[model samples]
Target: MPESGSVELVWLFGPFAVYLVMLGVYYVWEGKREEQLRQRYEEAEHGQ
Candidate 1:
């Protein structure tokens, strides 16, 4: 029931929106993982 112009808009921008969300999720996940690794490394280095 939508117009033809709007359909094109969705095709063009929908992937972009999804990509941005995925990029944000990846950034946050990597940040947390890196933090955990850094903490583990520091603990081991200073414990010796």
Candidate 2:
């Protein structure tokens, strides 16, 4: 069996690692969405 400390470390970091990955993805998605909206607004204004 593995040592007690090793198992504890995995359990602690596993969820944290997943959370960081998800946060990064969310941040990138929001940035792209915001950029798209800005471009559309600019196009509409210039067209008017």
Name every residue pair that clashes in candidate 2.
none
How many steric clashes does model 2 contain? 0
lDDT of 2 by residue, 1-48 (tens): 999999999999999999999999999999999999999999999999
Candidate 1: RMSD over Cα atoms? 0.6
As a TM-score, model 1 comes out at 0.94
> Which structure among the candidates has the greatest TM-score?
1
lDDT per residue as tens, model 1, 1-48: 999999999999999999999999999999999999999999999999
| Clash totals for all candidate models | 0, 0
Q: Which segments of model 1 are wrong by more than 4 Å?
A: none
Residue 26 of model 1 has an lDDT of 100
